[model samples]
Target: MRPFLASCLGAACTAALALPPAPAAARPADPSGPVAGPEASRASDLPGGTQSLPLEHLVPAAPGAPAQDMAAPQGGAVHELAPRTVRPFSLVGIVWDDVAVALRGRVQIRTRGRADGRWSGWQDLQNEKSDDAPDPGAAEGLGSAAHGSTAPLWVGASDAVQVRLTLADPHRAALAVPHGLRLELVDPGPDTPAARTAPATTPEATASSAANAPLAPLGATEIPAADQAAAQADVTAAGGAAPAAPVHIGARPRIVTRAGWGADEKLREARFVYTRNVRAVFVHHSATGNNYTCAETPSVIRGLYRYHVKSSHWRDIGYNFLIDKCGSIYEGRAGGVAKPVLGAHTLGFNNDSTGIALLGSFGKTAPPRAALEALGRLTAWKLGLHGADPRGRTAMTSTGGNLYRKGRVVEQHVISGHRDGFKTECPGTLLYADLPSVRQAAARLQGR
Candidate 1:
C-alpha cells in the first residue's frame, strides 16, 4: 500500500510506485483500430500479397542504437484479421511511471507447418498458458508525466509473428516489468456470461489470460507483501498501467528446451502443422554463447533435458529463449510459443520462428546494450501482439545498405538479426549488423 517491491514468483515483480501520483493521462485510442472484436477489415482488406506496417514502422534502434535517442513517436494502427480462425495468443503487459499496471501473461507460441507439402518444421503449442488478470487497471501519474500504456497481445495472426518476453526472478535486475506492453487480436465481445467471467477486459475478450510479458504488478525484491486475495483478484485484470515495472516470476522457471522432431518425429510431422497461416519472421542466432541467467533460471523442463539428455545427441536446447549478457531472458522451448507454433531455430525457417538465443559470440562480440535494449523492448512488445506492421521499406535501387530484394514487403518486420532470415551467419556480423539499430530501438519504444 505504499510503493511496494518484493514478492516471490506469482507476479508484479519489482513493485515500487506510490509517489505523489495522479497527473498523467493517455489511455484513449481503442477507436476499434488497435484490435478487438472483429470490425477491423480496412487496410483495403489485403489479399494480393498483403503488406502494410506502421506503428511508426515499429522502430526501436538500428542505426547507432541507444534507442535512437528516445522521443519522437505516434504511429500505431492495425486492423486486418479473418484468416480463418484458430486462436490461443496474447502478449499483454503494462507499465508506466507511478500507477496503472497489469501484466496478464501467455507467450509460448511455437506452432509450425509444412512437411508433407515440402518438409516443414516447429511445434509445441499445448494450452499456451493464461489465467490471472483479475483487475489490472489504474494509472495517470509518475515523473516525466508518466503516461504510456499499450502492452497488447493477442497472438492469432499479423504478418509473420515473433515475440519474446523472458524476465524471471525478482524482476531480473534493475527491475522493469511493463514499461508499457501491447500485442493485439482479441474480438470476442458478446456477453456470453460476461465472456465467461471476465479478464480480457476490453479491446475485446475471449480465451483466458497468459504470461511471459504484459505484466504490471509488484512485491518482488524479496517479498513486499500483499496477497489480499491475489491483489483482490487482479482488480478485474487485463487493463491498467502507469507505474514502472513488476514481473515477479522470480527464480524458479529456468528449464526450457526445443529442437523438435521427437515425439516420434512429431507424429511423422502431423501433415505440416498449420498449412497456410504463417507469413514471415525467420530470424536466428544462437551462434553459441553458452547459457544461464539468474533469479534461478531452470524451468523449460530443466532447460530441455540438459540440452537433450545432457548436452547433445541432438534433442533440445536450440533457441526459444536465451538472452544473457545480463538483460535476462532465459526460457527456451520445452514448450516454445507465440501462437500458431513451430520453431526449430531457422532453416527453411522454423515455419514461423520466434526463437531468441543470445548468449554470446555475436561473431565475436557486441551483444549487450542493456541486453540490446532489453531485447529491443522484448521485440517491440511482440510486434504489438501480432498486429505486426511497423513500416520499413525504402529502396528505389541506387546503392544500398540492407539489400532488400526478396519479394519486398514492408509494414511489420522488426528488430531482426540472425542474418535477417537465414543464410547461415546467425546473429553474426556483430549481431547481424545490428538489425537497423535494434529495429530503431524498438520503434522508439512504441511510437515507432
Candidate 2:
C-alpha cells in the first residue's frame, strides 16, 4: 500500500519541486500616475471590469504657462467633483506616474451615491508607508523601494467622487505632484448569492478530511529500501495489513477565501498561477491601522484589494493569505489556497514560498494571541503537505534585491518574518520578535 501510494503521488510532487524558480525580471512594472483634474488623460478599458482614468485633463497650465510645473501647487488643494461622467464603480484608488516623487499630505475622498443624491462622508485613505524592502524588477537607478500613492479606502457603492490633498508642510510644495493622479473604478462582479457561500473544504484543509479516516500514525515502522522488494511481494501475496492509517501530522484550520469576504472578483486582473514547492512561510503585518472590528474585515479587505490591484498595479494581493486580529484567515491572490502561489510580499525571495500577512500593523503593539495561534495552524497545515519542518532552517535562492544581491543563496527559518529576507521593518518589530514562538507552535501542531 505504501509503495502504491508513493508511486501515485511521488512523480507529480517531484516534478513540482524540481522546477526552477522564475527570474526577478519577470515581474511587471507597477502602473502609476493619475490626472489630478478631470478631462481624463487616457481612458483604458481594463480586464476584470476595471477602468483606468488618467488625469490627462489637468488644470491646463494656466493658458500655456509651461505645464503648470507638474509639481503640486502649494498649500491645500481640492478637486471638487472629478471631471468625469458618473459610473457604477463600487471601488476606487489613487494612482500616480512617477516612482521617485513622494506625496506628503492628508488625502480625503467623498463619493456621491446615485440612489438618494447623498454624498458619502469623507473617508481617509492611508498614505504610502515606507516599506524597507525594494520592489522586485526595479529598473536601473530605481532602488528596490516601493514608490507609489497611498492605500485605497472603501467607499461602498457610488457614482461621483471628490478628493482633497492638504500638504503637511508648505515648504515641500515645491515637489512636483509626479506625472498625474489616476482614479481607478472597479465593478464588483455579479452579486450572485449562490456563488458567495463559504467553501466547506479547501484543497489543503480537505486533503485529510475527505478520506474519511485518520492518517497513518507518524513513526510507523519503515522497511529498508533493500527489503522493499520482499515487502512488496508480501503485500501482493497478502493485502499487507491495510497500510497502518497514514500519519496525521497536523490538522488544517477554517479559512475564508477572498470570495468568502465578498471580494469584487472584477477588481483583480485574471489569475496568474505560478507553482512552487512550499519550502518556507514568510510572516508579515499589513502595516495598516488596527482600529477595526471583525464585522468590518470584509470592508477592509475590499479597500486593500483595490489598492493592491488598482493602485499598486500588482498581479494580485501581495500576500497568499491574510489573518485578521480576530484570528480569521482570508485567502489572498486568485489561486488555489493549497498551492504555493508566489506572492509579492517579500521583495527578494517570493518564489518557492508562501506569505501570510496579519491585517493590522504591529510595530509597537504585540499581535493578539488568537492571531498567533491561527498563524501556527495555517503554517502547520501548509508546510506539512510538502513535508517541510517548521522549526528547521532552509536555504532559498534570492531572485534579487537590495538586502541580498540577485542569485545569492540565503538561509531562512521554515517560518520567518518579512524582515528575515529584506532590510525592512516589515512584519513589525513586535510581531517579528514573536516568530520564534510561532515556529514552536507550528512544529507542535506538526508533531515535530
Candidate 3:
C-alpha cells in the first residue's frame, strides 16, 4: 500500500512554519487617478483596469448577398463595431447581462498592436458559457453581476479593437442574439517595480506564504522541492493527523504564490469557501493566446483576475492555480494552496475537484516540456495529499452541465481535461492529447 500523510488545519500548519513576516510595502497601490463607483474604485486600485463598451446592431447587407462579402456582415441581425481606438489592453472578451443566455453564434475580433501599430487578423472567441463557469445555482453563479460571457482572449498589448457577432442561422427567428452584449477590454497593467523587486507583506500574501510553510520561506516566490520522506516529515511536524489507511504521497514541488505574481488583494471578494476534499484535478488552458514573454506572465495573470472578478462578476478567480508556458506555477484563488478551496472553474464539477489552468491557448501548439513536467509534479503532490491516485479514476457528482445532468455520478480520470466534464474545446486539443503521459509521470512521482 502507498503510504499516506494525515491532513491538518491550515492555520496550524502555517503556525508550525513560523517564518518571519515579509516587507509591508512590497507592492504599492496604483498611482493612477481615482475613478468612480465601487467597481471602478476597485479597478483603479489595481495596476490595470477594464473598459466595457456596448455592441451596436449594424444595417443589413444588400438583398441576396453573402454575409462575408461586405466589409462587415452582409446579412440578418448582426452586431458589431467598426475599427476604433481604445486604451491599452492585453486581454478581451464579450459579456452580457444574463448568465442563463448563451451566444448562439460566432464572435470574432481583430486588434491593433500597441507596440508595432499593426492590425492582426480576426480571431474567434469561443463561446464559453457551456463549459467554463461555477456550478448552476451556486452563489457565484447567481446575482445581477454574474453574466454570460465568451472565453477571454489574450490579445497581447493592443490599443484598438473591432468586434463582430452573428447568429449561426440568420434567417431563424428562434436564434436571436443575447441582450446587454458588451465588449470587455482588460489591461493587466504594467509590472510594478515593487512587485518585481520586493517581497509581499499583506495579510493575503502572508496567508498564502504560510500555506506553503517550511517548503518555502515567508514571502518567497517559489516553494522548494523536498524528498518524499522529508515531505512526509514536514507534514507531521506541521501537526497533520495520522490517516487510518496507508496512502501514497509524492515529493512536494515548487510553486509560485499569488503574491509572487502581485495579485491585488482588494480586487476579489474577501470570504473564502472550502470543500470536503479534492478528488480530481481538472486541467485547462487560458484560451488567452500564446503571444507573451515569460517576463510578461505576471501581468497576464493579473489581467485574468480582473476579467474574472471585475468583468464577469465572479467572487474570485476561477482556477485554483495557473501555470505559465515556462512552467512556473502561480497560486490561484485566495485560500491556502494546500486546502480544498472551491473554485469557479469547470461547470458542474467544482464540488470535489481542483482546477489548474495553463497560461496560453493550446489548440494547435504543444505545451512546453517544462510545463508538462510541472503538471506531473503538481498533480502528484496535490492529489497525493488527498490520497487520490493520479493514474486512477474517481467518481464525481455533476451539479449540471452540457455533458452530465445534476446528481449524476460520473467516473473520470483523477486528472482530467476541461472538455472531459463539459462540451467544449478547452485546454486545447494538443494539450489534451498529452494528459496520458502526465498521468503516467505523476504516478511514477508517487513511487507507485
Candidate 4:
C-alpha cells in the first residue's frame, strides 16, 4: 500500500512537472465572437453580465468644504455615486486599473431592492489585497490586463446602487487610493435558460466533459459519484497509470462541470496552466453575500465568472472549485477537474494547491452544514488522489505574500483556510473555525 501511494504521488508529480507554467501576459486575447464550440454561441445569449461605472469625487454636505473634499482634516477624500435606478444586479465590487496597487480605503455601498424597492443599509465591501491573487512574478500574476479589486458583495436583486470610498489616513500617503477606480455591478442574469434549460452543445463543453470521460458521460451536467475501487479504476482509465500497490483513495464525489454552470467558452483564455502537485486545499468564502438560493447558484457562478475574467481581467475564474450552500460542488476554472490545474487564488500559495470557495460570505453568518460536508468530501477525494493526508501538514514554499516572503518554506495543514496562506479574513472567522471538523471528516473519508 505504501509503495502504491509513493508511486501514485510520484506519477502525478512527474506528469505535471513536465508542463511549465504558462506566462499569463502571453495568454491569447478572448475571442471577440462566439468560439467554434457548440457552446460558443454569442456572448449576448449568455445570461449574466457586468456593468462598470467610474466613481467621481463626492460633494461635501457641509458648506465651505474643499471641493470634492480632496483635502479634509482627516487627510483623505471620498469618491461616490449617488443612488440612481439602473438594470437589475445582484453583486457589486470596486476595481482599479493597476493590479499592483492595493485599495487602501474603506468601501461601503447601499442598494435598492428590485422587488421591494426599499433601500438597504450601507454594507462594507471586504478589501482583499493580493490575498486572492496569483503569486507575484508568476505567469498568472503577470497579466497586463488584470486589475486590483475589492471582494465582491452580493446584494440580491437590486435596481439602484450608491457607493462610497473613504481613503485611509492621509499621513500614510504612500497608501493612497488606487487610480482608475470604478464600481462594478453584476447581474447573475435570469435563472431560467441558463440553469434550467440546456443550450446547444459546444465543442468546448464537449472537450471539458471529455476530460472527465468514463467517470461521467459526455455532456453530463454533473459527474456521478463512484465507489473507491471504481474511482481507482476510473483514474487508470483516464490516463493515470496504476500504482505498484493498491493506493488508498476515497470515493469520487459528484461535481458539476464548468459546462453545467454555463461558462461562456469565449470569455476566457484558451490555454490552461499546470502546477506540480496539489499539496493543500485552501478554503474561501465567495464573499459575494448570502442572498442566493440553490437554484440561483449557477447564475451566481456565471456572474463571478464574468467579473473575474472581464472585470478583474484574469485568465479565468480564480477558484479551482466552488461549493454552494446546498453542498453542491461546481467546477470553477476550465481545466480538467482531476488535473493539477493552477488557479489564481490564495496569493502566494497557488502553485501547488487547489482552492475551494464557498458561494457566500461567511464572516458574520455561519456556513451551512451541507457546505462544510461538501468541503470535507471534496478535500478527501482530491487530496487522496495526490496521496496527501487531510489531517497532516506539508511544507509549502511561499512565492510572496503578506504572511511570508518568497522562498519561505512554511508547514501548512493539508486542508487550510485562505487566511492561513495570506493575511486576510477569508473563509470568514466562523467558517475558518469549523475547519477542524472538516479535517476530521475528510480524514475519516480517506480511511485514515
- The digit string of per-residue lDDT tens for model 3 on 23-60 reads 22211122011111111122465567898866542222
Which residue ranges in model 4 land beyond 4 Å of their true spot?
1-46, 61-79, 141-143, 170-175, 194-200, 237-239
lDDT of 2 by residue, 1-448 (tens): 1232234224544321121222222211210112122223323442224556653322211222223222334444332223234455656666665544565566666666656656555566555532422245632111223446554444555666555455444333335244455666654433444433223233422321222112211111111121212222222111123334343235666666554665544444444455457789999887655756776676666556655755565656678888998898887765555556667777777888888989777877889999999898888777766667989989999866557888889889989898888777778889999999988888887777
lDDT by residue for model 1 (263-323), tens: 1112111121221223333344443232223322222222232222111212333344555
How does candidate 1 fare on TM-score?
0.21
lDDT of 2: 0.57
TM-score of each: 0.21, 0.59, 0.82, 0.83
For candidate 1, give the lDDT. Answer: 0.31
Can you give the lDDT of residue 423 in candidate 2? 71
Q: Model 1: how far is 333 from its true place, Å?
A: 4.8
lDDT of each: 0.31, 0.57, 0.74, 0.74
lDDT of 4 by residue, 1-448 (tens): 1232234324534321122222232121321111121111123555567777655323222234334432222544454444545567888888888887887777788787877777676788888776588667656422565789988887888877766566554233234455677788888666665453344276656666676666677777788888776666644532357766656667888998877777776667767787878889999998988888998888888888878887788888999999999999999987778878889889889988999999988888999999999999888888877888999999999998989999999999999999999999998999999999999998988788
Candidate 3: give the clashing pairs. Answer: 2-247, 3-247, 4-247
**Candidate 2 lDDT score at position 253:** 64
- TM-score, candidate 4, is 0.83
